[model samples]
Target: MSQINKKWYQGMFSNEDWWAAWLGLFFFGLGLLSIWGLDAVGWIAKPKTWEFSNLIHDFSWSKLLKVSSKNYHHLHPLASLFITYFVFLILTSIGAYFQKLNVKKYIIGFTVIFFLTWLTWIIGHEAHLSAANATVKGHNYYQEYNLSWGLQLGGGASFILALIIGLIIGNFFKGFANKIKEAAKPEWFIKAAIVLLGIKLGIMSMKAMGFTKELALAGAAAAFVAYLLFWPIVYFIGRKYFGLNRDSAAVLSSGISICGVSASIATAGAIKAKPVIPIAVSTLILVFAMFELIVLPPLYTNLAPNQPIVNGAAMGMTVKTDGADAAAGAILDQLMISKHLKKTGEHWEEDWILSAAILTKVWIDIFIGIWSFILAYVWIKKVDRGNIKEKIPLSEIWFRLPKFVMAYILVWLIYLGIMYFFPDIIGAAKSGAHIAQGPYRKLLFMLTFLSIGIITDFSKLKGMGKLAILYAVALFAVIAPIAYFVAYLFHHGMMPPVVAK
Candidate 1:
């Protein structure tokens, strides 16, 4: 085999090629079953009321069946997004195959695509908005359709569903690949994956309004410091105290410290953290994040009503999943709007506030790429190079570097500047007839979720392996959180609050 082909064969899609196991699909089916089983057991039941912000008065199938666009079903708006699960993975894998680039080169390559799309978005807001999710609500069946109402119901639900479904399918396919023989995977695939993930994450951060340079510095500094300190502490408890290795601790710490559990694992993988570490780390982060997602929204609502930006940022940073962060943010925005509803009609202001929070979280996520780079550099310099007396040039950190993410970072910065400076132009452009450009965010998220799902296969997630559960738990869960908290305390509070209100 050619050296390039040889190298590609040992990649992640290669290393963990066993995921074609339908693990994701099975679980998705199981999740449905569990929901059903709960209903059957009377533990949980279908919602009796299908209220649409009190605006959707009619409960008839006809009312719900009203389609918006030819392709989009207003009745089941979620169905469109749900379809992306299959589409996103199939498309991305195809993109990869055709691009035929290695992971490193792929990351470098996406820099170009992300930039062009970003530029197109910058210049073509109207086209963007038209493609977005929106609606014409009817008050008393005579009034125009409620624009916000349609999106909140159809757009949001569908976007979320796409990610969930994507995860299921991606994981299932991955698992099946694992059980099968000689399944091929490309390592550089993650580079492309992360590059796309970064773009989405960067967009989310750009969405956060109050993510000023000073604030970003504070958040990044805090996040980095928190991961550095807290992760090691958790590592000690789990490793020296609980018996785990550096690689395992690295995975858990990375997951908690970054955007989502899966993204964290990918970061760990790029840096070559142990194989099992990413999986274990992601699981731990998910458990904790899910807890926060379910619990923290209400607390923030009651505790920090005036501080939507603060609460939102905290939630994004604290919550492990993008969905949790979004849900928490929306909840906060709604509460703020409700509080102001009686006196002010500035309900839409919450969107901006939520945007601010997402932007901050995205900024923190971007830092993960930087952190991975730093780790790689240090590993090559200190660990790989050994003592200073016997040291080679530390410049080899350049080689260990994942340079492609830099392009993504640069494009995001440029887009952020453009969008911020010309919100009016962009807004008008995005004000498409059917929906606003906001739907673009939804699209980006679906793609991101599907991408994540396609890359993960828990079938290979054996708790015991050359690198075992304890190790991964120690690295991803313990070490990363310790560092994150330490950084957080020094920089600010749990989150950076928006002062716009």
Candidate 2:
């Protein structure tokens, strides 16, 4: 079986990327069955806020398995935890087997990682840890903390904790980190989560289709315009200002301009630059992206207190990695929603702010394929000053394209179609969609945080201080500000829909 001779459909069975699509849609299909009251995915464990005193006072095996979402059947906490572990283990193990990983080790490693993630999730959910003045079911929870500093980190606290643990393991407990490496697949986890996010978007569109359309258009436009300005400016800085070679400048330009690792690799291949250039640039991109993930959520919330949607869309544009961007968006969503709820005493819809950020980055991700191809053609035709007749592979676009996007769009369109033909069922459908997109989606996100931390070693960033400086300057001086302004132009005054009174 020569590589080029493989059929397109073969990807379904072999490619981890395609497996992401399949797994996403699989859960999404179960969610859709919710319209008929199937309640399939609703059994997934969802952590609840608990203080140590309260937990000890009211401890029970049953209490541990509280179902987080309303309008669904409940399970014992132990049952929920075990079922979640069993389900994910089986599904991910299947993927590992097909991907030719050591399934036994992967299963053992994944079990450890999953439990650790859940532990962090549970601890982070402690009212003092995650809660703010945010409304849950229309009542302000922050009133209870009137005299105390509530941490108010929202769900982001869990993510930060998970990453910190992973980083500790990765940097200090290298042996254990290496053992878990087989299961620390952040991209795979996040991609699958992106698929479930489709369900969230689909449900949102059913309720607010017009807003969804407006957001999609704005996101696409913002990304396109940002890319146009970003590439050339960064390229010039790298070449003329930093005194780098053409190839290094081009690779650095795409790495910073587009979607981090993918963009760097794509541009490196496009310009036929040495593999080492992209590899180094990718490391730099990852470390700096982590810095942004930590800094931006708080900064954006403080700076743009009333502009949640704008901040989110801007985050999508500003953060480089999908993992970091989406993670930041999730944190920002929680933080801004909490702040807004505290201010207005109204419940803002969940996920819309996060979606705005993710959607904008998604647009950039989708464009990177086409952008890379153009770069390839430009390099062959002009940059290299070589033969204009040299062939550029159109297949590169498909290879670079984010397959999880198809799952997102598919669920959204299906929900929209249901809304069009059967308006009465929209309510029923939303409950089902919640199972797919709610706790299950969150589990995958937690996995992304831990995996990202496991892979990030700050020590590796030591020798690349100059590259880090360039990334920082490009980010704060150019990327962050312009991305914010452009996002503001498109998304200003656009707010996530509030829950109806």
Candidate 3:
């Protein structure tokens, strides 16, 4: 009987969550058609690495373009890039239109952001800036310049570059930043990417079914235990130290404990907190999430070089926002993988570490929905006894549920089924799967990084420094250590499956 219950299906079409599903599945379906030898989605523009010196010395206009990996080699690189841009423009524009945003601004802004993202992508992959120690065994770039400072940052260097560029624009050119904020929807981009990630997981799961099961079960358990331990301690801090009201404490607790902005907003609504509480907390969470994004990857890599899965799962638990968390996980994935490959001469599988992070975050995202409902009921019946007659809509759970997760799960199940039932076509399926999971997914992630930087305005946290301080302290003092231990408890000794050379 509540308003939250009224639009259970609205997220299906009205929110970024469904848009991610629709967009992801559109390409996934194209990949699915590849079983019949059709490369329906192969024309998407994918970038390749080139040295800055080479690019400067002998750069042709064509140097920047490449066809989507091996699967879509038939397509022209330039055409693929344009076609990919057009598809994303239309899809994201539609989402903006329905969300009651300035559609015209979104399209133009997205265009600028898109090109800027590609520019950063190309620059990021410059051999000196992004290369690892030639993990694939073809080239030994490590020996090129004595391997002293080749960055060795991998693709993550580019992502960080994009984020830095966006941050510069966001902080220094605030007005211009606001104009493009309509298209700076990092959460939307990341969710869409997460859906595509499901395809990757499915393909990877097929390769090592036991590994997937162990990683997933461990992630779920870690998330569950982390949530149980996190909320109360954070709630106590907000109440005892910060002297926050119950609603504020609950929202802050969820923001820090659960999946960041989503949890903060969900808790606020459930507890009937003033909207400003969540809004303020969401801002704090976003800014701090960036802080975590920037700091956690290298920190975790140094702290636990051997425990790749643990570091990743810990990233999922430590970083608050989905965009920041996933982004951090991705950076950590690249960092740890590159480091391990260089040190051990073994190419540790790429997405498994990322999957550990995302899977844990997904579990937390799923749990937050149920947790919000329980909180609502408790608040109504126990805390506010006068409102005991009021029924909490079961729809709140549906509303809070992350829809991209649904898309991710669905894609994973469908792909896993294909692998199980029609094993013969898996090779064909893999061709399309690579396109879906690699180039397409990377595009979304690049966009996410840029957008996240664009929208994050650290100066806005000026008036709320105390809350920010509290969040930072709690994150470092309480959250990070506990999360690491819990993740290590379940995921220790878990080595990512190595890729075949």
Candidate 4:
């Protein structure tokens, strides 16, 4: 198989990575127009917290759904939702066409996925499942709903519901799963969402530059240390104990210890391993990532409720994929915030915990290119000395680099530029930025949860018993514990800011 050393702009138009950048940047640019007093993103629809009995008593579209911004409140809720659906369908279909996917299947699949996603999102926002019990600024959802009990999951309920619904189709309804398979691109969806998260980080910097900087630095430090510790240990175990060949061992090590599917593919390309090595390993990574996404959030929430930042950063290190890590972080963020609000009647702002996870994973994503380049050089020079005639090109780094991160950084810098250089328009900029980072980013996340579930098939692990065992043991026994320790070392005392009631 060919390594990823193609031309600099080879995948700019055809690759999902670049598509993520294009989609995210396009939305961000629209959001930037708000500084001119235009509300370009306000047409997007978002779910509102509502109770079932109240809605039954007086059913109204306004009770369940609303436009993202007040500027578009004049639009009917269903009209706003239709606009959201139509816009995304057109945008993603263009991406599918460029990427050479079957455009027909993609549109059909996306249509089904989109509405199903919204259905779960609306249901998950039912006050009994999602509303907080505590009064915040004189607004108490529990009292308003007259509920005796609640899950208080916040937006996490939607995420969980989406995953559950997707998994049901993926596992039980084989034919239907195949139909939507064309639109189930979890990595693409998550990468785009991460780009929108850049807006959140930018706004965060404006509010608490010191804390944001500390969190970013701590995440970087923890990620670096964990990477240093994770790879060699897993590689040694794969070789010494598992008796795997060098190629399989290296690919598996990168898959399990690094950033999952992308790391596996990069390492395979670096070592000139057969394409099947990474392909096989990626299946394992995706399946295992689903389990982590499902189990880790509530586990950490109950286990170390006080160590919010620590748990978040640890999740960033431990979870294998960007989608799973961010999803798990979002769930953890909601659970921790909701629990804390119930216990203390103080609301901690959202996204800080989730940011901890994404920042750490972003650092890891940034390093994968350098890591792969070094591995390629070492493999050619030290391990395969007979291949001296072949030279590893520097372009390999560029090819393997995660492209969405570039968009994320650019979006963040743009926000910062406006904050420092054009302070007067900050309010206008934030009006749109909030919608971009809030409802828009969350919609992408909801898609990611559903898509990830639709793609994962546990039965695929049947033949790879030994590899699966190694993955399970390494992930839980070694990686998880070490990752948590490194996260705690850097983020022990850090905490999310409390919102005044």
Candidate 5:
């Protein structure tokens, strides 16, 4: 039960990577039953915007929560929510048991995290915090609620609130944080969410096939160009200016310039660096990712309000971890769509901008295996030939490849198959696909935001002064601007589709 992949199928059941695929596809299968007139996925509960005074005067669960689809309108909101909790608890507990985590601790921790996450989600959906100032399809929550002013954050408010609450616990309440650490698996949650996002991408392709193709190609090009420029510059700076050794510099370079924690681990394994190196670098990555997640979305939304696609692609390259990048993209999508709807009376189709971010990140995620293989080969042959004993294995490529991306691609292909071959069932397929990509994907995102914050202990950066400084400087000054420019070059003039308001 080695966590590291030794055999081709070693981690199929025991790895979080593989579990992401399993859980995503399992739910996806349930959603697909809609094509046969089944409503398997509609039982998941979702929160709605609510006014505090109204709820206090006349309290009802219906005011706060509802099942995802009309087919399950007969179920009580609390019953639906309990079913959602029970289902996730059982499924994730099974994964934890296989992955060799403390099952009891995981269950308890997951329960606390789930309820806390839902509480934050519901609070963030307060009408004043989430309602847009504009009227869309004759519905204006702000006007309906008679609010004088509003933050108008949409779903981004929930994401931000979840992070803040988790951060407070992680930083201030260390004992509680340690208790729940076993279930704070942000990467796993986000990967599963990415798999669910395939449904969104598939639906998008059905609507705008040509634009989807262009966006995918442009994302690939931008990722390639960024890799060429990012690693070398960061490596040179780490080695020359920061006075780090070859292994430290290389690991740090990949962590900062490529994907975050995964790249650090892969690069460290490639060069046979001490495990402590990637662990330390991973701490840096998680902490900084929180900052980027919090700061980048609003900055880009206001700074380049008109360049929605470019901003999203830049977010993909700039944010280090998949969780943070996708979180930032979701926030950017909501903020930009809300801003445009308020100003121009046009609502941009949701998830298109977020797709831009995920598409670029997916390309980067896919290349890590190849990049690490080359690094392993170079380290063995050219860099440290005498020290290394074993030859680099070609199987490392498959080992390091993100399994969830394969699930994502497979889901997308299935949708395309339906679009081309079974066009008539498209309406029914969309009914379930929307729920999978909507409430189900969003719930995973909420978990990711909280878990990411809970795991990130900013106090770890206190002692690693030089490395932290280099990461901060390299990320903000060098990487951010360059990534944004590269994103703009590839994605300029591309815009998200507008919906009738």
Candidate 6:
């Protein structure tokens, strides 16, 4: 029989895939069942209290100024978590050195690990353990997630660590693991991130973001207005000032108006827009993601300690990339954690601003996939400008679209269900009595990252390099400042608007 004639299931999965799928399902089922059983027992309520006698109960200048987030006594355990990621990274590096394990296996392993974690920590535990003690004391749950010892991914660190290991293997074995190259795929990471976000939301309250019905409506209006107004100006600057061509300009403008460069690059690529366009756009995103990830958290905390939502929303609007958007959110949360209830007392409502910021961005990301399709339609039809006729059928256009986006949309929809369907599932337990539910879009992101490293040649990413670098830098320049400005205008310099508070 011809390939197209094969059954859909057979066409998608080979025997090898079947075995992998079964094993994954088996383990995942066990984890979910175990967690649900715990919920059924209802035995894990927040302990009335944990005994921490050394607790200073203060957010002092000395406490905030220290290299760490903790006072001296609470320092030992906090150091261990950082050390664990550090050691885990080193082990991955050593394994890459001694073993010939493929990236696909590791990627699959990470996916499995993350899945079980989602079932256990998120769906299973309600992501409440870290905050269990504090929640009783009336602290917000964003602080809960951070303190929870799970659900924290920021700074591109894990991705960066993976890159280093991949690079080392690439140098020694030189394509030994080349065949397993799905690690660089951005779409897979995006999908996984969204799923986790949705699951995370299930356990948390959305009211904390101050996303009032009125504020949400107002944000939508401002968002569309900003897109219409600024997109053209951004396009002009790229075309006239930066000397970018039509394709490059489209990618830049899309990154600005819609998501960020990742969205820009993927959309640009799908339409067969110029390769240089995405390269420049991705480079710009990397630069700014780094800046916003590392710098903005501290800067915001220092400058206007109380103004995280304003700052975080601004970053999300401007930074563009979903990952960077979350990183900025984490920063805002951390800063809030460092702030105190009273100037002399412990910080209150820690992570509130950051969580709110992330939710705002999450809401914004819902539009990204839709907006990209619209732009692609606009480019192909109205902006064809030549031999490209406007006569293509809607079916043809639909076929031309990337299938991966369907995966993303499906994931997003599932998350929406988790969030709205049974908010109560999160409030109570996870067993059948309470009820519940929720990859790398990865082959592509691995390719994208390897493409960057190989092209960067593993050297310092200083100075201009190629189409990618210029595009990436331009993206960051456009995104970061705009975020700052927007946040300022909306919240008025961190004074805490009625809606935000």
lDDT of 2 by residue, 220-306 (tens): 999999999999999888777777899988888888888998899989988899999999999999888888888999899999888
* Model 2 root mean square deviation, Cα atoms: 2.3
Q: What TM-score goes with each of the models? A: 0.50, 0.94, 0.96, 0.98, 0.98, 0.55
**Tens digit per residue, CA lDDT, model 3, 103-192:** 999988899999999999988877788777764756665565344568888778888999999999899999998888889988888888
Candidate 1: residue 173 lDDT (0-100): 55
Writing each residue's lDDT as its tens digit, candidate 1 over 39-135 gives 1111110111123433245544332222223333332533432342334344344445444435444443333223322222222222111112221
RMSD of each: 13.6, 2.3, 2.2, 1.4, 1.2, 11.2
Off by over 4 Å in 2: 1-7, 68-74, 138-149, 387-389
Per-residue error (Å), model 6, residue 44: 14
Error in Å for residue 381 of model 5: 1.9
- Candidate 6 per-residue C-alpha lDDT over 1-501 given as tens digits, one digit per residue, 9 for 90 to 100: 233313434422322222222322222232234334332211111111111211245423222112111112333432433342343334333333233335446555434333222222222223322222232245444353344353222212233333344455444544543434433332333333333333333333333233333334434544554555556767777787677778877777777656666567656854668787677666665654555555666666667666655665665566556555554555455444434231323443433354445444654555555566677677776766568455433343333233333333343344345447756543332231112121111221222233223222222345544444444444456545555566566644342222111
Say which prediction, candidate 1 or candidate 2, comes out ahead on TM-score.
2
lDDT of 4 by residue, 1-501 (tens): 232436799889889999999999999989989999898998999998999989999999999999988878789999999999999999999999998899999999999999999999999999999998898667898998899889998888999999999999899887999999999998899999999999999999999889999999999999999999999999999999999899999999998888999999999999999999999999999999989989999999999999999999999999998999998999899999988888888888999999999999999998889999999889988887783499778888888889999999899899889889999999999999999999899999999988988988888988988899999999999999999999999999999988755
lDDT: the better of candidates 3 and 6: 3
Per-residue lDDT tens digits for candidate 5, residues 291-330, read 9998999999999999999999999999998989998899
Model 6 steric clash total? 22
Report lDDT (CA) for all predictions: 0.41, 0.83, 0.87, 0.92, 0.93, 0.43
For all candidates, the clash counts are 73, 1, 0, 0, 0, 22
Better model by TM-score, 2 or 6? Answer: 2
Per-residue error at 129 for model 3, in Å? 0.6
